[model samples]
Target: MTAVMAPSSSADDMPRPRLLERIGIPRALAWGFLGVLVFMVGDGVESGYLSPYLLEEGVSKERIALLFSVYGATASVAAWFSGALSDLWGPRRVMMLGLALWVVFQTVFLVFALPTVDFPLLLLGYGLRGFGYPLFAYGFLIWVTAVTPRRRLGSAVGWFWFAFTGGLPTLGSLLAGLAVPRAGAYATLWLALGLVVTGGAIALLLVREPTGRARLAPAGERPVATLLGSLAIIWRRPRVGTGALVRAINTTPQFGFLVFLPVFFTDTLGFALSEWLQLLSAMFATNIFFNLIFGVVGDRFGWQRTIAWFGGVGCAVTTLLLYYGTTAAGDNYALAMVLVSLFGATLAGYVPLSALLPSLAPDHKGQALSALNLGAGASTFLGPALVGLLLGPLGVRGVMWTFAVLYLASAVMTVFLRLPDSAATAAHPATDHPATGAPATDHPAA
Candidate 1:
């Protein structure tokens, strides 16, 4: 007797009418984006003026530098583990651990360390707090890759960055600017803490994607193996390591630029501190929008080509123009603004790398992203370190040239980051199942 076959139901067959999905967000992970935005805003509250504030409080320059160095180091390690741990424990649990760490350490920092100006306690509290946001933010990033379809992954990762940068120095600094005058830095920190808690609760409670609740790696995989795999993938997939280096180079110059560009604009070029700051804000504000634009561009224009040309090569040219053009323009604030804005837009071109790296090792995406995260964390330190080391001997121009060279090198490296034929096909899969001629689902099983 012949039996009639029933139609199979899958995520692809389900109608996607949600506004978030229409705008390229994975429907299930929408709340997580808002959570990241708010959480990063809390974390970034101190970024704009923390060093200056510490100095005013009598913390020595040496101690402030040391504190940030330690914090950056811890952040790097945590960034690596965010993906690795996400593979082992699930993104939600990792994010929760990060939130707990941030709350515990930040309280100790503000209440005890700041009150007494105890350097050791301050270091202990703040350094450890570094582990919080990377885990909280990048953990969500791993969740994005896990649940998002290959076709829309670029756009999804783009949204992840939009929320991330939007909260960070952008809104966070704005919030700090408004609050510090009225509430003072200490109280402002408490406000930041509150935002963090609210954001964490929102994400953890509201987002109910099942994949985030379960291990990303295959069942029975040992924890030790999972972590070691994160390291091993660097060598096993040399392209992943190359991509990490490219990623590091992508932002290293931004941090380095911060070190000396302010002096160049304010002192050398005769722009006011506020004007320099406005320029900085304008740059990143332009970047924030392009992050979303390039994500869609990457998906449509080909990730490799988009990253290589728009991100790598574009940055190389724009980096040079920002320095030399600004120098030539002298007090041409309008011209300077245009140059800096171009640099910022080019910077967003690298957003596609987030989507591309994970595609390299689909079965081991967590490890792949761990490598990417390591580059990101390293940039926080490497850029400033480069400036600290080179500013005296090389001067600003030489340093700008150095950053331009790095961009060119990244462009060269990115040319080799092409996906395999099968992987490329998977990334842009056909709508119908070839064998059965049935509708296929791009969404992976949660």
Candidate 2:
């Protein structure tokens, strides 16, 4: 199919803005990036040590696994809805609702559940709080895609993931490493609550992007229809569903790794909790950097090729290396760090899929994004569920192998996510809009 190109001046002839454009930050949504980074850091403060912390609080490993699985399930649902709701209610409104849910439920989890070690309360509160970040974060993502020129969408989304992951596991782990030792885990949790609120306030108040404040869908589109369309698009565009599956496999192991890797590194391998947190931070620090690198690479090298080979195949190889190589490294922290860093970098290889997926159904961008977000949320659930189920029978090595196999499968599935030849050509930088220098409005699939 021939993609339609919007008429515009050449981007090359247009005067480029300063550092933000150079660094791949969409100038229109800069505040949103800062907001997501801080907000996610608050959310992710517990990621490095939360499982072990629960065990110390008298929660069984089985229950901890269950808690995370439930949390993931809720997150998945919320992630899907974030897109659909964005279409109906506007991104800003959806973000507000998400922030409110997070604050209220998080307070319940901390004040009522954690203090008493009430398992039921813990599940209810934390699981429900899972709705918060995706709405706030992915809602902003829709905003980014709407305003960013098509030629730069990959880089813009890359910056989004860079901020999102950077805050969550990177700086978040680093913050935890310092805070847990100083203030204790419970107090550190309270600190996270404060950070989240502060970040949310900044984004809502400071960001002035007009598109996010109004519905992206047509004016007459009914809310129910928008919601239903989000689901129906999966079948109407089968490639989108395939892309969702690939997106799910992209991060299944990352979430699973959090469930067990801490214990493995600390208990089995003789590392301190702080050391492990440091390792986690270092690993994702590498990831945030490569998020930018791969964003640019995908724009130049072809998004599908980048995702298939670098994201899917490279991750498959690195997932195995991260497990076996680290094991073989014994007490060699330096070597282990290198292996883990490589794994983290490969994870960023899938960043382009965020740009690629929505382009598949531009006329239904919100619905298309819902499919992508569904996969994202499912991975959170699937990863931990896999660990909870397989860790008993298959053990860590077997679980690692399972993830590797899934990555390989994702690489193969990416073969089916091809774009039309003309659409692909339109997306190339050289053929971008002559006036604004933006790429064609009708984006290629995959």
Candidate 3:
């Protein structure tokens, strides 16, 4: 759940620039961004590095896929509860618990579990990984929203996600690769543990504990019922999956698919896994570089429209390519991977949506983002399951086509979405919303 801006004291009593113009962004955001590092380390060490290690250790591909699924499946349940718990006990406490769990998982992976362990037992232990994800993710989300001025909320949230997803698979890839190749998988676990412990320590020092009723009670924003209810209303509309919500879910498909992509390329495209990984890594490296580059573009242009346009166009081209490019003479492995990266990049939309939801539901940012997380988490799990099921029936071509259909649908729905009448949209045209300033008539004026 995204918690962009925690409710704060009125300007008359508070020391800051009325909350809106405050200046602690660097200090406050450092903690929030660190949250990304913690989560990514946990994910990277386990998902990024461990899967390959386990494969080397003799786990079957099907089992590995199930292992991956278990992580998301467990996280889906854990995060649902984390939302209510974060709302109740405060995200800080919940987050610390998650980090503590991370310590357990990393330590357990190294000292106790052996290659002789039964596959089922290993899966159960891997499922424990989910318990850590929600708490840290929520911590980062809330912390980012709490500190960022509304004006910069879009860029800030985008940057937050940039670190969270990009950290593990991209930046940390080198470390994981180096550790495993040099010292073995067990050593990699120890090193990842070190990075996370450092991050967790930072979390404790940097992030303030969310206090009793952080939301403004007098303004009627603090009610737990409102938080839950707003989410209920949004989901009931039948349109949320089409909105920024879909883009969030889309992040996982590209990622989850990549975990199995070697199997796809080798089995379907007739390349060795080594050759496929080389191609895949090159593509992923490109994807990671473009995230920073395009992120700047989003800041300069409108985050919302850029996300829509890029995702839509990217989805369209990728869909056509997947349908026929793999069939043609060139095949263009690099091009295919670039589109895959684009499929992933469109996810930058979540940032503006993160900031925008709070602007849309000024009183209920946490709830909205919680609902958003639920959809995203659900899609992450569903994507792999769908792939597993469909790959046998539809075959590899069918699976690619399915992604095409889903993304194209995403593009169509994007056109009709109305921005919640927000100060962000109204205050600036080119600076705020490049393509979708959406004429003054569509959304209610803030």
Q: lDDT per residue, candidate 3, 282-341, as tens digits?
A: 444555545554555655666556656675556556555644665563346666666545
Give lDDT for model 2. Answer: 0.85
Which of the two candidates, 2 or 3, achieves a greater lDDT against the reference? 2
Q: Identify the runs in model 1 with alpha carbons over 4 angstroms from their true place.
A: 1-13, 58-63, 258-274, 327-333, 432-446
Model 1: residue 260 alpha-carbon error in angstroms: 4.5
- Candidate 1 displacement at residue 354 in angstroms: 1.5
How far does residue 146 in candidate 2 sit from its true spot (Å)? 0.8
RMSD score of candidate 3 (Å): 5.9
lDDT of 2 by residue, 1-446 (tens): 11222221222234755577666666656888898899999998989999999999999999999999999998999889988898877788998998999999999999999999999999999989999888998888877776666777789899999989998789999999999999999999999999999889888998876667877777787889888888888888998999999999998999999999999999888888888999999989999999999999998998899999999999999989988887887756888789889999999999989888876765566788899999998988999999999999998899999999999999899887776775566555555454323454544354
What is the TM-score of each predicted model, taking all chains together?
0.88, 0.94, 0.77
Clashing pairs in 1: none
CA shift of 60, model 1, Å: 4.9
Off by over 4 Å in 2: 1-16, 429-446
Top-down TM-score ranking: 2, 1, 3
| TM-score of model 3 vs. true structure | 0.77
